[model samples]
Target: MWQWRIVGNGGYTKIQNVASGTFLDLFTGTSMPGIQVQGWARSASESQDWFLRRVSRSDVEIREILARDTHNAANFQGFRQDLLYLVLPKSVRDAIYVKSGLKNMKDRGQLFDSDDYAFFLKVEVAKWGVNTLLADDFGILWGVMFGQKGNHGLAYNFYLNENLDNIMFFDPYTGDEKVDMEYKAYLAVY
Candidate 1:
């Protein structure tokens, strides 16, 4: 289903679709761990170059060697842990930390649904008055004008801000905050 050949002695390889002839590539301005790979025309860019690391006789890991590598190979585990701290809630983080034992900060952000993430944001905004959601994944498609043919171009959240907190939300529907008083005013129970 796929074929590849090394590009001379430059230590780069081009993987091709046997049926389509397109090479595996990282979309420009959007190369990071956990991001999806795409198929594009062959080029001399390093985004298309891959490093093959043989973990065992039968196991090999394909790594993309971009000009600016975000991951630190020497401390990969620590990197993943730090990523968890940036996105996960305190309760979920504590649970994963306890369950993982020596696993450090385990990622459970993907497990949460939209409502769950929204609720977490709601609670955080109420309790700490935080304004933004600091995230680890940079795969969001923003400002995209789809199906416009040459007029439409793709845009991504290649967040290069000093704080790196690109996504911010403010709840407009929620009314005044409620607190427990002497008399229990019970609303509709879920």
Candidate 2:
């Protein structure tokens, strides 16, 4: 009985409840890889019957009760792979890393490696521990909102650019200042 907004182009491209047999057009009706499956209204087509289970207050797990006769795409680019699960694209990951000063330090041999990125995120969160959850929540919402609203354009825009360092100081959230963990937390709750 949950409602989900469907994104992408194809046979399905609108908001519909899980009970209704509405299938997401992962390929946007075009032949592409990594097409995603989304819940829609029931059309009696077996594609819409889904089992929605609550995993946590802020998370839900969706399982398809009936397999719809749809072509599953591999490495599908824009569609959401899992419900309530945010996959950080390379661009978004890089943007966060660069903006948080992880990239610059890496070049200086001061901070290089995946561990550094993890530490950076952790330190950023610790600086504003009160807002850590909020920031994480905001990041999740931004990830999903961007996916649904712009077809992952925000993700790509922030993530897939050569001059990441150039815009590293630019914060897309406020537009006036570069995005910081504190700012992200503020935005998350507000």
Candidate 3:
């Protein structure tokens, strides 16, 4: 049995079905112009990686992919793709894995429940004495739940917008290549 992992590469993704316990891989290591992608056993190299452009949405403005199906929880579940894109940095990811005693992003626990993980995410950033995230920075905050007036997955600005108040929040959702969110809805108070 192999534990599957989901990694965002581009318009497409490399994921192990969290529920199916299977890996989403390519048939083989074929780099031809047009090769099919499927699920298979884990390989020694990144042969399973692929790009999905035909089915992917065109409106999505991708800034970066934080992580893949990283965490599991009710509140956090809604933001896994967002959070994965948030905590995928090598230092930050290592810090969480070490402090939370998690071998990989699939591992879940109380620390990864909800707001707790968000807090830690912020703390990790502050640890480096960095504030005001850039486009590449996938910083998220535990803000007012939907219906209120804030965002839980506050991503960074992919590019400048005409309206100064409007900032773009990108989500690495498997369903959609990327989801554009209002930066104002994002709340980060730690």
Candidate 4:
């Protein structure tokens, strides 16, 4: 799975779904002041739509000018050819696999385990320049969920610690916390 961060001018209020090419309105189209924006699908506008801005082989940023979907709501989900344009830094990728505890014996390695729900998250204390420990932790949590293993509730709790409070919240639908508490839990078990 790939994710993107979109930035635009003015106050666009939606994150465009690259696959469907439809814009998803963020904040229910209220456009509150000082709120972060995100990406969504909107049938009638491109004001907040964006194109890719390559930062490196593993890092590309999205540029646009809308307020919608600019914040937590703009995060891209699943795999999509169009959305792949947002490249992640090689270091970030490496950190993901490492933190997930997936042995990278060879230069080429698999990103996830068989269940596809769990991953080894690498936390490089030295690589804190461009990456944050919290960010890597969230990546591991999300990767597991995307792979369909960790409970949604657990993932949400970990996400909140990673600063994802804007998108999800505590709810009855939350799943087992034991699996989603943190990647450290898995390490302790092993």
Candidate 5:
């Protein structure tokens, strides 16, 4: 599914995929350790190139796939612990983070799902401040849209753990068993 080919002139190489013709791109803007290294539209960005390093007199090191049989590589396509969910596509996710829901129009001036993503996050946050039930209080009603071509695309839902200290959300994009909340962008998943 992947091909490591030689490209450029001065000892440069490019890693491309066979199924989708996209190249391995190391995100354009940021350089954080977990910055997304994804498959983006092939272009002349340095993120699309790789450098071969010589370790010893005879050892040349390149990429490595530690766990290859867990279906992780096939789904995510690459490795970046901080950006593990990038298999979902940053163009579809976001810039600073690969987040879902509506932050496009409200807080974060992002363009990924600007209108819809902002709406979804707004709904989730609003739910916390809203406590109006017909039998209890008063509030306005609202709704969300979900589909491939809707204002809000529903890939997953958010929930809290039993203790409520940390969030336990579900992301169809990330099939993770355990997620560290300290550094990663996505909340912990079941």
Candidate 6:
């Protein structure tokens, strides 16, 4: 039976078994993977904390949910509107799109397919530098790479408070080895 649901993001999570009010715990609080696991009371112990190693294309459904529902509205409430304010004119949008590599694109889905998708967003974000203050907005942008290891899915970082340290742990696609380290470092520099 499907009885477990993950609470919290890929960074630090607690898998709760709905059938019982217990969380999935690492047996004896072992730090390595493939260790024995069991259900235990919610004690906020280190054993109960888990990190999602990857997000793949097959997890698009999960990604979409996190994107749409988990994002902190306070951080992004006016971001799109503000972006529009700067690039709403047809000419401006077209130019920014072309610079951001959105020209000839039929849908947003293609955005997920591009290797330079973040760079595209960066172009757009760069355009607003003079008009908008986006220091806090960078976190959400960094999250865009959340599941990129699985090969560019529709998921863009909607989960909040994501950072380099936590994101590096997620493989997202294979849930195996960590990927996109260079890109993450690049963004950190950007």
Give the range where candidate 6 is weakest over 10 consecutive residues by summed lDDT: 78-87
Cα lDDT tens digits, model 2, 8-107, are 3345334454566466433234334665665433344434433432222122221121011021122222322324423233454445545665434433
Q: 1 or 2, which is superior by TM-score?
A: 1
Candidate 6 Cα misplacement greater than 4 A, ranges: 58-190
lDDT of each: 0.32, 0.31, 0.36, 0.30, 0.35, 0.42
Q: What's model 3's TM-score? A: 0.23
Residue 119 in model 4: lDDT: 22
Worst lDDT 10-window in candidate 5? 55-64
* Candidate 2 similarity to native, TM-score: 0.25
Alpha-carbon runs more than 4 Å astray in model 3: 1-103, 106-111, 130-165, 170-190
TM, every model:
0.28, 0.25, 0.23, 0.21, 0.26, 0.30
Q: Tens-digit lDDT track for model 1 on 1-190?
A: 3665445426656677766778788877267987777888887777787775321110011111111233222322211111111223334423422442322323354564323333443343323313343533322111110111134321111111123232112111131111211221111000
lDDT of 4 at 54: 33
lDDT of 5 by residue, 1-31 (tens): 4565545536777777767777878877456
How many collisions per candidate?
0, 13, 6, 40, 6, 6
lDDT of 6 by residue, 120-188 (tens): 555564565435554432212223332223343332221122222122222222222232332211112
Best by lDDT: 6
Query: Would you list the rank order by TM-score, best first?
Result: 6, 1, 5, 2, 3, 4
> Highest TM-score, which number?
6
Q: Candidate 3 lDDT (Cα, whole model)?
A: 0.36
lDDT of 3 at 128: 41
Pitting candidate 4 against candidate 6, the one with the higher lDDT is 6
Winner by lDDT between candidate 5 and candidate 2? 5
